[model samples]
Target: MKTKPNVLPAHNDCPQTTTTGNSRRRKAHRGIEMLSAMGWWSYAIIIVVCVLGMLFGLYIFGRSGSEASNLTQLATATQRAARTQAGFGTANLNTVLYNAGQIPNGWTYSSGTIYNQWNGTVTVTGKTSYFTITDTGIPSSECISIAQTLAAGGVANYLTVGGTKITPASDIATINTACGNANSSVNSTTKTIVMYVGALQ
Candidate 1:
């Protein structure tokens, strides 16, 4: 009898998958862990960049504020210096005018000596002559202009500052040159500004 050996199907030799779902779950867990590690690095980098940006902003703001403060201080100092010089100049002019006898009937005196005897009004030729003094001082263009005009009107004038003779200017150029080196009454040791004027009549 030709009995065929009890043969099964040729595809029955493959291994049976019993825990396929468990394998898939393990693979998914590994992928999540990898993503978590990469996320931690990215978060750290972002925090560092933000902190650096804040620090840089603070540095720039501080530097600009300091510069502005310095400039303000410089401007204040310059303004103070200018005021001081101007005040000193005004005092010098008053002192000189007093000595020249222009403030108190200096025109009445025969001698051209400087005097500090300005007290009250005096009469000359039946008319009471009052000393009319202008408040123009150094660094003022009017001061130079007045002096030049007086000289041209036949009024001989002499002026000195701090023991240095102030040579009268003959031209506009000379006036500019002379005023720069001019000193005030405060610079003098005698505390007196000397100026003598006489009518050349």
Candidate 2:
């Protein structure tokens, strides 16, 4: 018998090992490109958002500060015009009335003598959006000047005096309507005269 043919490893019997190095490298490159593109877009978007937010904040802050400053100035002007330096007992009503001007609200002045009412006193009081000059026995004519001052100060509603409601009109007409033709007596009958003035809220 002839010698057995030389035994050689069969092609299908040996473990098959396939190399995927090229495919893996290609996939990795694609993934890296996608990640890089996403990172660049995200960074750009973040920067834009931050810049817009800062600009908006600055605008709001500036507007608020301006409004606050305007209010403060208004308040100061009102206080300066309304408050009197004269004390309660030593106040001169004529002088006070003469010096009165258009002023904001929240002012009061108490004086011992207001009209020729024999030691009668008066109180000029201001509410949140209105002002009142009150006296037990003062002539209604005294309110003319005061009303004019109030009007110049920005009062728009109807003014009242001596238990009468006076509708606003022209400067002269308003004064005439407010004071009227009737004259009140300075007697002990407690005839309170109140001059009401409307103010901005």
Taking all chains together, each candidate's TM-score versus the true structure is: 0.30, 0.29
What's the lDDT for residue 124 in model 2?
Answer: 48
User: Over the stretch 96-184, how does candidate 2's per-residue lDDT look in tens digits?
Assistant: 44355322222222343333222334444555455455545433434454444433444325445445554444457745564554454
- Per-residue lDDT tens digits for candidate 1, residues 1-201, read 899999775787866777889999999999999999999999999999999999987765544343223223222332233233223232223233334334332222333322222211211110011111111122322234433443343322443322334444556554434443335543311222223332212
List residue ranges in candidate 2 displaced over 4 A. 1-20, 76-201
Candidate 1 residues lying further than 4 Å off, grouped into runs, are 1-23, 81-83, 86-201
- Supply every candidate's count of residue pairs whose N, Cα or C atoms clash at under 3 angstroms: 0, 0
How many backbone overlaps does candidate 2 show? 0
Q: Deviation in angstroms for 18 in model 2?
A: 11
Top lDDT hit: 2
RMSD of each: 22.7, 20.3
